[model samples]
Target: MGRVVAIANQKGGVGKTTTAVNLGASLAVAEQRVLLIDLDPQGNASTGVGCAPGSVVRSSYQVLLGEVAVEDAVLETELPHLHVIPSTPDLAAAERELFGDEDWATRFRDAIASIRMQYDFILVDCPPSLGTLTINALTAADLVVVPLQCEYYALEGLSQLTNTIERVRNGLNPGLTIHGVVLTMFDPRNNLANDVAAEVRRHFHVYETVIPRNIRLAEAPSHGKPVILYDAASRGSYQYLNLAREILDALPIQAA
Candidate 1:
């Protein structure tokens, strides 16, 4: 069975999609079969991996609506072992339609379950809200990885996210747990960033790898390429590779 990890955080601009794209690519480069499920309607992850949302025929929306199978919705990326279930703007409406269904929270769980055995890892890129889509991602995931910005208000709403995870674990997915928290867009010159990192480390299982404020990381997405492929020597690329290795090392033996 594949290890399903949800790259989630209710906070936007925290590098959630960036982490999903790069980590999936990094794992694929390491010879692990990776399936990236883009749950966010923005479809940034889909674009980051070279899948144009507007051009995709079958997307997460169709899969969630039961119009297509997960395998049929999967799209090949530029990377050899990396595949993605692209999302479209239509997915934004899934939040409203899903609430009317009895198994709204488990829709994703069931959709992904049948395809779990095909890949070594599956990464879900969640939206920046605690809505039905995010709930679906959390319920489907075995582990959750939160990308936290190194800012003074970084801890704000974190309790709410954790509480939601607890509720999901208790009511929807009993095996759900936090994998680890990764600090993103870090700056060594900022004292506030250092302080926030220390505070997070004291309270949570924070990853040692910190993603620096790199221009290359910001630029790669626009080109529809991961930082590793855009510029492998960049700091952003190195940090994400470190994060991928750390994540692999931290996984359960079965998953590793």
Candidate 2:
């Protein structure tokens, strides 16, 4: 089965979507079949991979609502092996609707079961909150990849996220584990960013690749393309590729 990894961070502006899109693209380029699931209502991951407005009309919203199969919602990306389940604004309403169901937390996990064995990795882009939607994603995931911003305030929410993960592991998913923390938007000149990076490294199992604050990385989303497609030689693209390799190397191979 494909490893389900959620790219998460409760704090916004921490490169969660960026990492999801670029890392998915990088892994696809490496000949890995990747399924990029957009759980964030913003749908940035869908757009980052170039999903058009018309294409996302039937999306994760319908999938969660049981109106469509996971495969029915899957959209092909520019990359050969990368596919995405686009997110719609309607997904924001799923939280309220799912609350009445006793197994709301397992909806995503169950929905993805049929397609789990079809890919090499299933990467979920979670919203920037520890709300019910993120809870569903956490329950569905086997591992989590946290995209942490290299800032002092970003460190503040790490404990809360970890606590939430711990609770999920204890009650909802016993197999859930944190794969690693990835430092993003690093600026070497900023002493505060450097200090925060050091502190995070001291406490967490951080990935070797640190994503730099690149102009190309920032501009790619607006153009509806990943950094690798927009500017493959850019620092952001290269680092994400390195991050993908690190994750691939770290994940254990399972027997068929």
Each prediction's RMSD over C-alphas, in Å, is 1.2, 1.0
lDDT at residue 239 of model 1 (Cα atoms): 87
In angstroms, give how far residue 63 of model 2 lies from its true place: 1.1
lDDT of each candidate versus the true structure:
0.91, 0.91
lDDT of 2 by residue, 1-256 (tens): 8989999999999899999999999999999999999999999999889987666667887887788999888888889899999998889999999988989999999999999999999999999999988999999999999999887687789988999999999999999999899988888899998888889888889998899999999999999999999999998889999999999898787755
Per-candidate TM-scores read 0.97, 0.97
Clashing pairs in 1: none
What pairs collide in candidate 2?
Answer: none
Residue range 59-96, candidate 1, lDDT tens digits: 99899888899999998988899999999999999988
Measured with C-alpha atoms, the lDDT of residue 59 in candidate 1 is 95
Q: Candidate 1 deviates by what RMSD?
A: 1.2
Each prediction's number of clashing residue pairs: 0, 0
